[model samples]
Target: MKLVSFRASGADRLGIVFPENKVADAQQWGAANGMDVPDSMLGLIDKGLEFRDSMSAKVKATAVDDNADYVYDYEAVKILAPMPKPARNIWGIGLNYTEHVAESARSLDTDNKLPQECIIFSKPTNTVIATGEAIKHNGNQTQQMDWEGELAVILGKGGFRVKAEDAMDLVYGYSIINDISARDNRRQGQWIVSKGMDTYAPMGPVLITPDEIEDPHNLQIITKVNGVEKQNGNTKNMLFRIPEIIQDISSVMSVDPADIIATGTPAGVGAGRDPQEWMWPGDEVEIIIEGIGSLKNPIVDDTY
Candidate 1:
């Protein structure tokens, strides 16, 4: 089942998207039926698999009943990031794609070396923006703003020193993320400032449950700027992969429920181009992943 967080009546509410382009307000359905459903996505995720499964089954059954009072057209509501306010900063992998590593080297952004271990970074919670929202193009801060489209994993369970083989058990769902970066904002060797600026992370249309996806590594990830395709790659090309990423991070710190991990992006980013393209105030960026849907956002000048 596809899950979403959308704004209705000036408040964020949990929703389930039907295949027919309709959204069912889960909170209202739960309240009406006397089910103990959470009002927020994070709360639902924290309820554990048994509860989620029970809720999903009921919601699916209700859809069959054809309830219209709590359902709305998909285009009518304002969609927010699956987790509008993440519990913590988002964990990101850097240069996890071989081609991206090479391109970063070519662009003088990093050394031409394949990582011996997973390269991890973090983006502050304030960086997140939902689909159709505007990505702030702060010209006074950067002129070389770029994009990196990647697949993100949302964990459902927490574990310390989780075995790589058992890592999949922690996955709750998947979503798309555009890792926006300001090429000229690098300070020292850290990425927090360059990549963690406000409105730099564009994520979500919906989060697809693990049961719907056969193999996460086999999906395709494509990115486009305006109407022109910029990056076209597959998850199979990822150097670290999901299991290894989970194992690597959990070896040091616990992986908790609702924690977001943005698997590194593919090549063909604006900085990797020959002439070096950058996003401007009027441009639009869209990222499409095979199992997940498209996440599109426009660029706007930052007044602040």
Candidate 2:
């Protein structure tokens, strides 16, 4: 089932997309009537993996039920990040692609080159933005801004010291993550602050179940700025796969359900070009991954 978090009335709610992409409110329907699981995607995962599976099945089955309580057209509502406020830190891998690594070498001082081991960073919870939201393009603080299109993994079960072989079992589903970056701030210091800017992490349209994607790492990740194609690559070039990343991180800390893992962006970023170009105000950025829907946002003049 393809799930989404959307705004209805004045609040955010959980929903499932039906045959034609119609929205079905999982929570409101459960409250007014009854449900097998909680409304929020995070809540359903907290209930355990079995609960997620059962609820997903029920959501699919309810599509044909004449008494279905709540159903709305796809365009009738605003799409929010599948998990508005995830419980754990958002972990992101950097320089996992050879070309991206090579670009970093050219842009950074010798001392700032890629580490021998996996290079990991974190994005705060507040950085998470819903699909169709505006990304600030102000030039006051940062002179250069860029985009990275990557496949993001959302965890379903909590686990620490997980084996690489068993890592896939903890995943809830997949979503496209636009790792918006501030090139200036990033080159100045670490990514926690630069890449963690408000609305820097725009994710979603829908969270597709793993069953829908036979091979998560086999999809294409493409990005465009103002209708001009800028980045085109596939997950096949990843140096560290999903299972290896999970194992690498889990060995140190527990990965809670809903904690996002931005597997790493593919090559072809703006910084990788001979003459670097960055996003400016009035520019539109669109990120699309196979099987998952596209995430589009306009870059506005950010006063902040």
Candidate 3:
């Protein structure tokens, strides 16, 4: 089932997108129709995976009555990251794509550039923004702003030392994450400040269950800036797949339910380009992931 979190009429609600791609208030239906998912996605996660499964079944069984109307149009609500306010830490795997690694090499001196093990980093919770939100195009402070379109996994169960074989079983769903970065800060040496700005990470229109997608690592990812296609790539080219990432991270710390793990971006980020182009105020950035959805964020002048 396609699940989403949206804000409408001053209240935040969890919902299921009908086959028609319309919204059905899951929280309302769950309460009224004996369906028992707690009001929030966090509540559902805390309730456990089995509880979520039971809830999904009940939601699917909810019949559309002739007299009942769909709660809202798809476009009527403001979509938030499917699981906003995620449990704790947000982990990101970098340069997992071969082409991205290759392109990155060209940007560095021959002596300093080469493919290695996955480059991982963390983004504070404050970095997340949703589709249609404005990205802070903070100039001067961050003269080189770049976009990295990535596929992110949301965990359904928390665990330490998780095995690769069980990695998929722990996933809650999948969503798109725009890992926006301040390239100059990256060059300055610490990634946390460079990539962790508020509104730097824009995620979601919705999250799709694993069952809905045949292959998580094979979808097409494309990014457009002002209607111009700047990045085009596929997940099939990932150098290290999801299982490896989970195993690597889990070995160090516990991976919690609703915890987001960004799988890294493909080639074509602005930082890895010649004459390096960067985003400026008035630029519109849109990322499309086949079978998932699109994320659109406008680059606005830096107020700070």
TM-score top scorer: 1
Model 1: lDDT of residue 263 = 98
Every model's TM-score: 0.96, 0.93, 0.93
What's the number of clashes in each of the models?
0, 0, 0
The order of the candidates by lDDT, greatest first, is 1, 2, 3
Residue-wise lDDT of candidate 1 within 1-304, one digit each (tens)? Answer: 7899999879789998887788878877787767878889999998997787777677667642246577888889999999989999899999999999999999955979899899999999999999999999988889999999999999999999999999998999999999999988888887888899999999998988887789999889999999899999999999998999999999999988999999999999999999999999999999999978999999999956
Give per-residue CA lDDT, model 2, range 102-140, as digits (tens). Answer: 877787432345556667899888778888888887677
Off by over 4 Å in 1: 31-34, 60-67
Model 3 residue 99 CA deviation in Å: 1.1
lDDT of each: 0.90, 0.82, 0.82
Candidate 3 — worst ten consecutive residues by lDDT sum?
108-117
lDDT tens string, model 3, 41-123?
Answer: 77766777776677767657766442444377777887887777766757988778877777777773322343466677899
Give candidate 2's TM-score. 0.93
Write out the backbone clash pairs for model 2: none
